[model samples]
Target: MYSPTPSDWREANRKRWDERVPLHLASDYYDLEAFRSGKDPLRDFELAEVGDVTGRSLLHLQCHIGLDTLSWCRHGASRVVGLDFSEPAVDAARDLAAELGLTADQASFVAADVYDAADAVPDTSYDIVYTGVGALCWLPDIQRWAETVAALVAPGGFLYLAEFHPLADILDDETGSRIEYDYFARDAWIEETPGGYADTTTPTVHNRKVEWQHPVGEVITALASAGLRVDFLHEHDTTLFERFGSLELRDGAYQFPVDRPRIPLMYSLKASRAVA
Candidate 1:
């Protein structure tokens, strides 16, 4: 298939995210002050699935604003480094780390594309390589992304990813019931919506952004192909965002109405590089 993403995706997507930095920082959605007061942006399942991080070095790929990265530090990760393509995002992350009284050795942020993570991070490898939610869609090639991330994983260490289920891409956005798009379609998805998800009413420029869907199977295959041992792939019925109009927010999670048949709205996976 002909690809238009290679020539233009980075600049467009980075511009979109960079512009949203201030919006996200000020918006009630992120609530920076509350975060400073000790808010956990991470999902409960994520905390349990990844297990203890005490004294372990962690590299958070595509860590926007460092809320989750800093959270790992609170969870006892000895060192945490966050990387993002947008300089604005990385700056915000660095500020957050400092505000939390964390030094560079404890928590650091780098401005770099996720594809260059192996070469750009502070260390050659980490005990844990983490990818947070809603980040995978921004990348065009799951395979290349897998290889890049896999190389950053230290021997006996693992990579944990929590992402929106790609199956949701095929469903209608309003109801999330009717099949509306092809799941296997290989093409760049361009969106020109003028606002960020954090504050939809807040108007913004640099609206053009590109995204792509990678099926759960494709992601697993990519990681395994990159020499990681797949430990577990867990699908969750709840999500943090109101992805569908019909979703109901209950106990910090959004779920389909009780009458509606439940489907996986998010998924998490653990893939580990074998200890030599």
Candidate 2:
């Protein structure tokens, strides 16, 4: 695990994420009702392209609250396991699993830091290692993250990821029109003052959060170095969530301000081990 300069930064960020869990569950972004009724928030492209997962042992990394993980089980994954760093989220996931009666011999939840507990998870155990949206932005290093992914996969197994595009990160959050941040990797920790993304008025009373950006090339190269062959790299003009300030929801998709029509909003990649 690559240590941050100030160790307190990580703790503070973790706390902030823990506090945001309930809010996210309540937010429209993660509609619990829809999810409970067998609705899959993931786009059709991902569902269609990922193909049949029935009877597969699937591992979900950074599975906040395990909504998507449970969704995978609902979609016929034989065994589904969710791993996350947040204790509150993990607890909530367990409770939801029990309440929904989704618990089975094949479903379980595990909690640990993504970087530190790599060895804790069994090696060559999972047939499919899946990651969801809004996951990669929390890490500090893409190479280390890739190494973690490589360590988790079984021989001949596949790794799948759907994340916000690097180009989307370049837009100005306030105006949402001009490009502000760089496309390549940049290391600058952002500290939001108090309030959370869902409720900006109530101060979170914490201001330390860290995030890292990895470009499309950097991500592809890192995965390839980890011995995962790229099967598909897709850039979509739509997003699964509201990212920019000026974006509008149309026909179940989020789009730009009409001026920047060429930019990609999200990306999904499917990679498999050489043995696969």
Candidate 3:
């Protein structure tokens, strides 16, 4: 029975993300150099699913270091704001935006917990609320998150979410055959991850953190309950990273073995608020 205050878990995860900022900045996974040279941080699936963002207000939640957030700016978003709980991550995001010659009016980063995002961000509703990979696991309550997301989206606007499939989370990354974790969110998945996903060679000071799992049904239900209408849900056999040791890289994506049973590695959903 693992139970901790929400503040405690949040602080722990925030520390972990804060420490990973520097490593991600220098890591090839993020490729800050290429991003500076006008490379788009967004993936092909999200671009196709979310469609064009030209001249629209976009808010990126759990946006660490703001690569995707700034990329939205390049994709023709009129206004962009990135929000994260980690101060270091927020600071680094601001620095990168500045270094890339992006004015504050174009893109900005704010330090705030996602649960408290409604209060942290100035505008109540944005044209688009975009959240990218590896962001939702850190959250403890999906219902509350959905509420915040709902509130952030304006009437006729949409919330775009792209995350690792919950099925993938349950499977053992080492073997990829047996289920190692619970599919549903019963308790916190506490772990002592010394090295993060970005750079495994370097050890982190904030090693202990908590994570939660939300199945596809739970995710959609939460959004629906929050008053958002589901437009569509898409699953992919490919993932952004080589989560499993046996995965093969092709066309810039990591996928399971050809002979093995295929399963969804990631999912993307688009939900929109009804017109007033």
Best by TM-score: 1
Q: Write the per-residue lDDT of candidate 3 for residues 109-183, one digit (tens) a residue.
A: 889999999999968899999999998888878999999999999999999999999999888879688987677
**Candidate 2: Cα lDDT at 131:** 92
Q: Can you rank all candidates by lDDT, best first?
A: 1, 3, 2
lDDT of each: 0.92, 0.79, 0.90
Model 2, 1-276: lDDT tens digits are: 123345565687788888888787787767888888777866788788788999888889999898888888878898888888889998888887886786556677887887754665544468889999888888777888888888777888888999998887877886567878676646554656675556655556556677777788988999999888999999999986577767788889888766765578889999898674
The better-scoring model by lDDT among 1 and 2 is 1
For candidate 2, what is the TM-score? 0.90
Candidate 3 regions exceeding 4 Å error are: 1-7
Give Cα distance to truth, residue 134, candidate 3, Å.
0.6
**How much is the lDDT of residue 93 in candidate 1?**
95
Candidate 1 per-residue lDDT, tens place, 31-72, comes to 998898988888899999999999999999999888999999
Per-candidate TM-scores read 0.98, 0.90, 0.96
What candidate 1 gets wrong by more than 4 Å, as runs, is 1-6
Q: Which candidate tops lDDT?
A: 1
Q: Which ten residues in a row have the lowest lDDT in candidate 2?
A: 1-10
